[model samples]
Target: MQIRRVLAATSAAVIAATGLVACSSDSSDSASGDSESSEQDGPIRVGTTDAAKKAWAVLEEQAEAAGLDIEIENFADYSTPNQALEQGQLDTNNFQHLKFLAEYNVGNDSDLTPIVATEIIPLALFWKDHDSLDGIEGESIAIPNDPSNQGRAINVLVQADLITLKEEGLVTPTPADIDTEASKVQITPVDAAQTPSAYGEGTPAIINNSFLDRAGIDPNLAVFQDDPNSPEAEPYINAFVVRAEDADNETIKKLAELWHSPEVQAAVDEDAKGTSVQVERTQEELQEILDRLEEAERNS
Candidate 1:
């Protein structure tokens, strides 16, 4: 997140060069030291985009029992939490997966680190008025159109043997990757959030767990889903992230521990309602996946 401050200052300089007045701030010095005090007397500000406050009540209670003040800040957008963490506004965030964090770091030239692996929310293929994949063989299927999720949608289809990507080991595959002649379903790329509503007779779609929850759709209705235990699911595994310097911090480590406890696991299960699988990938394995993702990002 050191790079956030640098980018801001760089923008200010550019504005000044263009004969524009630039606002200034005196908090840069203090921002750099904020993470160091996350576990001190002050409360630890945890960032998340999901139902962390509602789903992780036991985590809060456990942290309180351990004398650690916890503040869960729920974000509507995925990008802001990382920006906040980088600028020292948050001690750590728990919303994004390895590939997402890797892309953020690569795009911003920062060294944000993933300290723990949490759960793998599978993007499942669901259909309306159809019970099986074969019933919707020649139908048009909708998938997310975004760069990050589009590949994920395609992967689900590929696993179902409905389509095949032209290249293997793609981190983010667009519709271009699909081999049209070989594919059984006609791939229709739509907004990720729109996939849930796109389903009907002769129409199937890949729906992400988050969006499906928001739309009140049941994931049990899915015809196909990616295997969470497979190595291919590594990139989509979510984690707790922090600035690289605070990777060894005791508070963050304890928080990760509390997340994997039985109470928290029960909460995750209750909240997910069988939509996602809870994963307990080790810290070393997480870093290895992150490194591999970062390498792939750089090459891309």
Candidate 2:
């Protein structure tokens, strides 16, 4: 989860009540909803968020080259694909990270698992025309209004040398937890979904990649990215998620294999302009990462 989902984490329950549709438990023959019936079995079902269209296009090409057909469904909200998968409405999804998956599974009791990680997308510090972070007056910083995202924003500020943390590895940072008064930067705490709009007010904003891209900001041009390759990225690197039971399914294995191929990495490298790095972690590894995140959250 990035700042947007993090910001929505607390309010997620309320929103989940009214925002999400009922869960579905309809799984198909293949792990990702690709029927084993025949090659002519229409199309292989694939579900993902609206934000992931670019990456999936490359994946789609890979699938076609691998002799598999693909049908891509764009989900508006973040919660539907899993439910659709449970209902057998979809074959596979690729929009979430490990933290989101763990939280979702714990809350919903869904057995969704991730076979491999895809990209390390950083929740970055974005600004409209402020040349550099040095130009950002710490007196005012607009952060995501959501609790989880607020923490992420706080952490980003800390990373930019704009502030520091009371604890080294706290997960959810609150206003009261600013470590030092000298760096006591004021935060606007705008809603995560609205953060991209916060930039024009002469205030730097921290937001997720979707919002950043939606605002037409080149994510690569951001003043600072959260450093997904850093050791600190241990708790928050993003991944392509699926049901836990599908962890070893052949379709998932094939997809994961393709996702990890040199071709995919090359596509990412070439297409993203170095804004993304490939990630590949096993289900156990993801669980371990989630466990670490839970511990961080607990002590935050």
Q: Point to the candidate with the largest TM-score.
A: 1
lDDT value, residue 136 of candidate 1: 71
Residue 55 shift from truth in candidate 1, angstroms: 2.0
If scored against the real structure, what TM-score would every candidate get?
0.85, 0.78
Q: Which residue runs does candidate 1 get wrong by more than 4 Å?
A: 1-41, 200-202
Runs off by more than 4 Å, candidate 2: 1-44, 294-300
Candidate 1 lDDT over 1-300, as tens digits, reads 001111122232343356421122422433354555444334566777774434567777777776666666666666767877787656678988888888899999988998888899887888876667776777789888877788888888888988877887676777888888888888888988788779743468888788877888777888889988888888999999988877867777787778887788887887778666888877788999989988988997
Question: Per model, how many backbone clashes are there?
Answer: 0, 20
Q: What CA RMSD would candidate 2 show?
A: 6.6
Cα lDDT of candidate 1 equals 0.75
Candidate 2 has its poorest 10 consecutive residues by lDDT at 1-10
